[model samples]
Target: MSGDYSIYTGQKRTFTIPDYVLFSLTLAISAGIGLFFAIKDRNNVTSKEYHLGGKNMNILPVAMSLLVTFLSALTLLGTPVEMYNYSTMFWWLCLAFVSAMVLASVVFTPFFYNLQVTSVFQYLELRFSKPVRLLASFIYILQTCTYMSFVLYAPSLALNAVTGFHLWGSVAAVGIVVTLYTALGGMKAVLWANTFQALVIMAGLMAVLIQGSIVTGGFQNAWDIAGNRSRIYFHDFSFDPTTRHSFWSVVIGGSFFWTSLYGINQAQVQKALSCPSVSKAQIAFFVSLPGLILIVSLCCMIGIVMYAFYADCHPMDFNNLITTSDQLLPFFVMDILGHVPGLPGVFVSSLFSGSLSTISSSLNALGAIIPRDIMKPYCCPNISDRSITILSKVIVFMFGGVAIGLAVLASQLGSVMQSSYSVYSVLNGPLFGLFILGMFFPWANAWGALGGALTSLAFMSWIGFGAFANKVSTAKLSPVFTHGCNWSVTTTAMTVTTTLRTTTSFTGSTEVTTIAAPSYPFIPMYKLSYLFYMPTAMAVLVIVGLFVSLITGCRDPKTMDPRLICPLFDRLFPCMPEMILRPLRCGVNHKGNIRNKVYEEADELPEKIQPIDANGVEVKPPHDTEAGVLKGGAINQGFEPIDAKTPGSEECITHL
Candidate 1:
């Protein structure tokens, strides 16, 4: 212990050998998984296999990977604090997960899967232009990299505060282990490691919940105490956009936010595309939803248990036990599970597992994006497959180093760390809007996308940063009591004096002076809840995009390829007349190909009948046409034969 414990609990606790061993095993197994895959697939060195598991990955592992990729250390450490401080209204975010999954599975997956592209940004290029693709790719790279750095740093900081673990050492250990496995084993390693880590994450959360419940006299008692304290709120159906965690804000705004993440973000799109078939990819997303809800519920309940344990004595108010809310969970773990030997280690391992799964997924995603989006298309078009494979692994290590360095720098950025969430929130809406514009509106050209994205970025940044600067907080914390604290004599005297001085000024009249409430500049837009940022930005982007497109001579929907457009009307209103749905789909063909557009112009047909096998190896087709097209649905099914010469090509048919 750091000798600071005597001020409060008069007990010093630290990690034991069992704890360290458990934590070490988590890291070792993750790296070991990478090594096993690296050695097993040594002979086959291809970019597709390395980045996408040759698009033949099993649904279960990929589903687990998707679940864990976005569920980072931030969610593990911060969400419990959110629940303890505010209300369980955040639980409504589960509905957002369901909505996002529905949109991703029904709207986004079919479009991307039909294209058979490496990166999701490729859709931007096919739908609009290369510049649009590059812009979106660059934004994604910046956002993910910065977010990953914070993800690596936050847990280490919390762990350092609770345990005596060196913060920088934790950062290095996680960064190195994730980089090693991701670079060596590639996507296969990432998926399996994520699956294992997901289990560890749940186990750790369960340990905390079970132990905390026992300490608080069981779950029902804890719930009753929390409910009595008004922390179990769920039906906040306020119509005001500024009301944070209200049913509308969380469900509606959260829907757009999560849809942005799952629908268009490269990390998620890459994982979804790893499956061999469109239905498999959709199934993976649906399967992940239950896990998402389970994790969120566990985190929420842990907060309630935390509140029940410290119902009378708030940790921060009692001798400043913790300097930040993020440190609360770890401190509570040490307080309750300190003597439990390996439990602390298991919890810490769970924290590290969250970071490892996230960073590994991001590293693998960056590895795929950099090579496919930037390097191959622009930097070196003639780059061979073997060379691209080598380059991708190298890029993973390089970006891993960059992330680690940024994480070290993040230690000095105290308040900026808090503001980073706002920054991420603002960007999600605009990015999702750009993709929506491309997919839904056939008239939206490249200029419109660029203009809309840039405008939304500016508009959201103004709101996000302005709100941060104004110290505008929408989530009002419930009252906490410190009357039950066993304060030291000296500290008690100092606190009494400080409290009296704030409420009364020393004047000759001996009259109590009323202190004026701090004035917050009332900016209406700035007061909008963070949850609304995504939907608001999306609206701005779509309106601006449509305006710009109309002014700049919009594309004729009839001439555009139907594969690039989402068949929204056909899917939703199947009973509607074809003539009505055709216009609603912006002239997209019902059979999934436009009659007026040649297939060759939209997507290049392969010159040989080569398709990837279950093992991710290339295999020759049994029958090949004179035009070198495979007769059957050899390319993972749902695709029709292409007629290069004719405009009525039955290519890229959707089974979705």
Candidate 2:
């Protein structure tokens, strides 16, 4: 019995020919999508088509693209580990997703869509100054690069654990494949590929959940077993900020984190801007919510099933079964499903798909931002469209290489979900704050925005790096048992013997070591939960920004562009009295000033407001004002200009 158990434990599954074929087919499909698009759009090598899909994408594909862009292999692999090791409190992030998407649609989406800018950071230049835009662009580049490294590293780590693939080789292969597709097909290819990958991810997750539950005797049995083992946790209402996944942290803190991604992150915002109109973009955002929730729930439930499956024979308790929690899911897949041909391939492909979608999106965004925000604006304004296209492809390839290199360094980090979130919060928090300051507070000057962002960046970096260096462990892992194992393994007797030997060697005494140990002093801020990082950083930026704005002499709201502001107060509370709304607007004249001016000007003109063409040449207005000609002669039938005094007028028309 002992020999058989040892043999069983030692033997690991390898990918069979069928598994390899299926995995290859996945890669081939992704590449083929890019190739098709590359050939189809070969003649139209303009920046607009390459970067924004010609601003003609449909709602469903764009919605799916947005969903997968942020999901990543980190979510697929790390989220399950999180649920298995900790509590289910993190599942409440579904609520955060809801609130974050709504806020993005109402606030950030309109601003980006109306501005007609190639890069989201260009809004900073228009709102503040060139220096502020440059600063933001650099921060976004750093943030996305860091995040891409984690995404690329996650699947590679899991693959190595299960399939015995060389870690760096897997990283290099995935990174190169994503780069080639992204460079070849651009935004169109990325979005379409994302749509396909999203289906694979869902199918893979469902397969795992269904199969695991069946193996565990059913989901109800799994649930009961998990509850018995104290794994079914959801009602942690603790207010302590240090509690890693309390109700407050997962919902409130997670809201800010998701908002930073969905609302303001370039990779996400770029997808929203691909739509022809703001309404379609908003629809896409809402459409993505259900799928997002499904994916997260699937990952969480998979964690529960895994815990139940290993309730007795804990994999980690066995000697060297796995080195990290992140490896647990892939190991479970191979141990359970490897015998079934193509099932392992499906799971592995899903992991790769998640990483490919995320990395490709980041690379595409980098390609767009380098030329649109930095190169064309400052370095070479007169560069031709063809040269810009070439430059963008080169930028994508270079950044992909950088991400592959950084992935090797990511191996040194702790839990993928926690470490990635910590790094993201440090940068994204400040970036989101800068956008909020500009959109909501019209009085905020460039100096204030710049000061606030820099201060927040420095402060968060200190806390983040300090916590990482001190190795402050916040996770409270659930207990595991090895008593059920039939094989000879490290047991209580071995542990006691090892402890006695260490004690004798250290203290020159044979007394047993006590359970109570000396506690080392730690910084309170350093021990702050990773969930609160974004909120803390945002608060710092806003407080410092307001203070600095007051000292630097606030920019007059009257002089500010109404198109840049979100009109959040008016949109949310339409019936609020002007007296209260004025201050809450942070000095933004959302409705009365901008709308009144446009109407006043229109009434004074004899032949209606003559619309300007795309080339800035004045053009004759269409025969009637019913279609509402925009400032640049783009006719949007959606917004018909109403009387300035009319109640609940479309104030957003001023943006057009």
Candidate 3:
């Protein structure tokens, strides 16, 4: 703990503890607020109101949600660990992250707006067959489940080590809180809570950073110590496929990962799409960018300060503190901030909040996508309104179980986000390409899409493992060193306590058996990074899918399945497809395929009967229960109760 240093100490190693009643009361109050807002409004326009906080959430929470979702707790703790390994070249990753948000807003988001989608993978259905849509949704759900579970578990581990909270108790309590609120309030609860959690998290970190700095003798001392050869700014400009985090590697490779994650992943995009307008969704994409800089900067800076505090002052028996860099922040919170009465509880609650807020959105997204994308196509052609609502809830419960299971399985992985995403990219990276093919490459056929997608995944997986296998062989010579020289001096003492620390190692000694090469290969926790891996995989899937689709002579965009397309895209760009579908005249043996402009004008006239399906394609009109709380129909069915607005509850295909 930085607070344990002599500079800040005047016999303050153990500060005054809070009253037991006060501690429990504050804890209960914090947990209750989180629980109440989440559960109380479950069925109250929850699909929209809860999932997106009814799309009427304030800017603070929206900003917070965006920050928390993109920046995980692992990020909060892991960047520091990496800085302890190398230097501050890791800080440049901040720019890569922000650049991704900009790309999403400018390049990829417009395409999603055109799809007119309720869920992200709705594009798959439009571009391919039922199998494709199911394939993408299933992959995404599996990925999210693994991810959310790991995130949940990571923080519990942090808290358990700090507060002595039972490991399972911490996991289950936090998990239950997340599930109850998310399950009840839907997206609305999630974003609002996210907004709250984001702020608290920042507060806790900033407090630790400033307090840590003050203890280590202000700004210049901290800088001289941290700004040495170990934390040097530049590394290499060349691309190295085998090693991760290079200049070229991040720009191109990271772009692919971000495109698939932000562009298509339902968990992230769904929150934005749940908003009422395309403009709002687009603007929100932009809003999320700047926060990345603040987030990454603060996280990396904390690592710098941590080195300053622990320079010569290693904790009790622990000689090597760098490996526990991730643990340092939480330990600081408990040992330092815990001295303040409500602050410690607030900090812990804040930490738990990240897992809760992000997980809630994941579960809600899984609920919305699974039944609508996969089950509805097979179980019942025309689903009744009542059943549709019931099915969505059932999906929420079912997926909650899957997420928990993934979390438990992922616990052994060193970092939560890294482990889950590595597995996800194999499934995700290939899917984004198919979505792009369907939207822009009108000629992409289902068969071509399938074949190309498979080819892409195959290539990406090979690259990921190849890099993983030959990691030690690729080392550049410009020897990296100047291990932390700042550690010898104590801020309070006139005498310096010098010691050398080139690399961090475990404190207690243990016998080691070294293996030459190729130990166990397919371990899940030991996979490549999700961020880079997914991008490589996604790029291959789209390029191959489009090439194969076009080569197979499937030139008709109309042949593309509707399930793969976004509903938002269609709603906004309806005319383009219609113009293509509108009949063209051969001009009475004139040998030309000119569109009949006059006939097109005539067809634009309103008809007496409305087509059940918008496209002139064969589909079983889903049988809906009597309209429930809809503007035009009777018997409010969807989510509205009959008493309030039961009669004329026919849904008019509403989205956020």
Provide the TM-score for each candidate, comma-separated.
Answer: 0.85, 0.85, 0.72
Mind giving the per-residue lDDT tens digits that candidate 2 earns over 1-656?
11112213344477778888888887889989998899999999988789889888999999999898889999999888887877678999999999999988887887666556678877776666667778999999999999999999999887787778788999998898889999999999999999999998998898889888877778877777766656677888989987788899999999999988998888888898788777899999999999999999999999988877776666676665677888889888876677788887899889999999999999999998899778876889789878988899999999999999999778899789889999999989899899888888776767678889999999999999888988877544456655555554454312211100101012122222223322336577887789999999989998898788777566556534456678887766779998888788665445522332232212111212233333333445444542123322223223343444433212212221
Clashing pairs in 1: none
Worst 10 residues of 2 by lDDT: 496-505
Whole-model lDDT, candidate 2?
0.78
lDDT of each model, Cα atoms only? 0.75, 0.78, 0.54
Runs with alpha carbons beyond 4 Å of true place in candidate 1: 1-9, 408-421, 475-477, 489-519, 573-580, 593-656
Ranking the candidates on lDDT from highest down gives 2, 1, 3
lDDT of 1 at 404: 91
State residue 241's C-alpha deviation in candidate 3, in Å: 2.0
| Model 3 agreement with the true structure over 1-656: per-residue lDDT tens digits | 33233222322222235523433443344346556775576355334444344545554555567668746666676666455444565677766666677656555565444334556665565434555666777767766876777777777766655655666776777676666656655665667667767776777667767766675676456655555424434564655453445665555666666656676667667666555554666677677677767777877777776665555444422433223434666665554455566565555555666666667777778877866677666667576544655566676767666666666676655545444556556667777777766655555556666777778777766755554454422222122222322334446632223343323342322222222344336553233334567666655666777666556544332322322222333334446664443332111111111211222223121111111122423333233331111212111112232243222111111110
> By the TM-score metric, which is better: model 2 or model 3?
2
- Alpha carbon lDDT at 228, candidate 3: 47
